[model samples]
Target: MFAKTTTSLFTLALAALSAQAIITPTSPDSNTVVKVGEKINALWTVDSTDNWNDVEIQLMTGDNLQMVPLATVATGIDGTKVASYSFDAPDVSPYSKIYFLQFTNGGATTNVTWTTRFTIAGADGSTTEPENSTVYSGQTVQWGTGTLLSSVTTDGSSNSTSSSNSTSDATSGGASASTASTSVSMSDSASSSDSSTSATSESSTSASASGSRTAAGASAASASASSSNSNSGAGQVTVGLGMVGVASLVGLIMAL
Candidate 1:
């Protein structure tokens, strides 16, 4: 009877150990921030004695007694070979400080492991602060609908494109203004140079005209002086000839 009781006690202990969780979740811890529609990996390490061949990953919320299943992350994961399960995070509303991942052995609810609480952000990069104090009427926490990450990324890219276009337009406008200013400056300089050249030409022409007038006046005075000298010589010659002829006529009458 003692041997039978001892064998029964050992068998019960072995059964209890088998029912305990052999999977240990390692990721999606307190510091993890999961985005909606983003790929997330639920990483874990399994005990060497694990006998489970398949597993199911679930997104859970609330305390242990009132735990709520938010979504099924993955099912039929090969527990024997895969230490992690990858899935797209559901489009669930931002939940702060109360979200965790639960891994269950295939067909056994008792054999399960849970990761530490993590945050889920919306597609608009919206998230609540950790340790939120909002009051809840029930023990179960529910996630509302949220936008997808793809939509947010596309919107951000569009805004960036618009900003680049605006900057390019501004730069082009500035360049045109600068070019206009330079053209105006060059035109003003050219006008000033033309005015200076015209003034110099006029001064040269006036000087040339004054010099010609002075030369003409000198030539006329020289011609007048030569004509006066010629007339004076002719008058002296005529007076001398008349005086000699009269002297000759007086001498001949004395001889007779």
Candidate 2:
């Protein structure tokens, strides 16, 4: 009986070591936080298997969002028994997401996943003014702020939470574009001011010169008319005097 009990204990210990399919990840650490627009390259190293003929590479992303399925990658067998895989970041993406690597060959399999959390965000792109990062009026913005732009694991098997899951509820904008336009207007303002002043000065100078010429012409015409009138009055007075003198002489001759 003692021999049988000893045998059972040895078998249990072997099972515990064989069931250890999960190992350390070569990629992002579990619970790691990443910014938006990051390329999540999930990699794994597995325990060698008896069947290398049917090795498979698989990745899964889990959150409250359903319909997103597992992905498959095809890498040929290698003598090293270690495999590497990569995926490029998309043009637009959720605020955050979860990713892990897996290896399978028939009954034999290996799993490597993060133990903590991971995150991606726009804040990684640049720092914002105190007034422009977000517009919620004092609401705290978590790393995984909402469901629309984030994801979480399911089945109650783990404690995973992303943003509220309302990707539409989130909105973002940048002052860079608006600031560029404003800069253009500011540069042109100096030219506009100079042009306005030059136009006003030119108009005033032209009006002053025209008034001076009109006043000078009126004075010349008035002087010429007065001189002609004075000459005619003098000639008329001389003619009248000659006539009176001649009549007086004729009367004296007749009396003699």
Candidate 3:
């Protein structure tokens, strides 16, 4: 009977030691707050002989510390079993004030590495409140202070609690595409305006050249008209002299 009890005690002590020889989370401390969709280095120290093939990563969030499965990562024994995993913080609406990490082997009875309690929040430290919450006079609202109005309206009310799950996984790829298209359109418009300006400049040059030629032609035409008028005046004087000589000869013949 004594031998049996001693054997049982030894077995229990061995199990305790085995359980104690597990992973140790060593990156973010208890007071650290993580942002949604932010990549964090999950550093840990592991036993060299332990199996790392089926290590499960989980996040315990919310006030109740609800378990949410994260991912399964691989750990290998390369001289020092110090493992570092990159983890992207999840988006949970109404930030998780009480959150921690749990890393364990995939087994019914296995040792675990429970990290310190941290916070999971939006990138801006923003949280969502229940839509049916009641606010009295001078009560702060959602991260902002609001002044109470003179009148308060209470039409319908209910006593219930609800939970919402949100994710920040969607990226801004569509916005980037829209910006690229806008840039291309602006470039095209600029090119079109440059072409129009060039055409206008060419038209202005052509008009200036045409105006200069018209001015030169007008000057030449005025000079030619003046010369022709002076020649007509000289011919009229020569004809008048010949008519006078003929009248004088007729008078002399009459006197004879």
Pairs of residues clashing in candidate 3: none
Model 1: colliding residue pairs: none
Estimated TM-score per prediction?
A: 0.45, 0.33, 0.38
> Between prediction 1 and prediction 3, which has the larger lDDT?
1
Residue 54's lDDT in candidate 1: 77
Candidate 2 deviant stretches above 4 angstroms: 1-190
lDDT of 1 by residue, 1-256 (tens): 9999999999999988876647788998877887776766778886656865678777777665567777665667677677876666566544455678888777468777788777777767578754433336754343332222222222224466999999999999999999999999999999999998999888888888888888887888778777778888888899999999999989999889
lDDT of candidate 2 over 122-145, digit per residue (tens): 555532222212224575322222
Distance from true location, Cα of 148 in model 1, Å? 12
Best by lDDT: 1
Estimate the overall C-alpha local distance difference test score of candidate 3.
0.58
Relative to the true structure, candidate 3 has a C-alpha RMSD (angstroms) of 18.3
Task: Tell me, by TM-score, which candidate is best.
Answer: 1
Arrange candidates, best lDDT first. 1, 3, 2
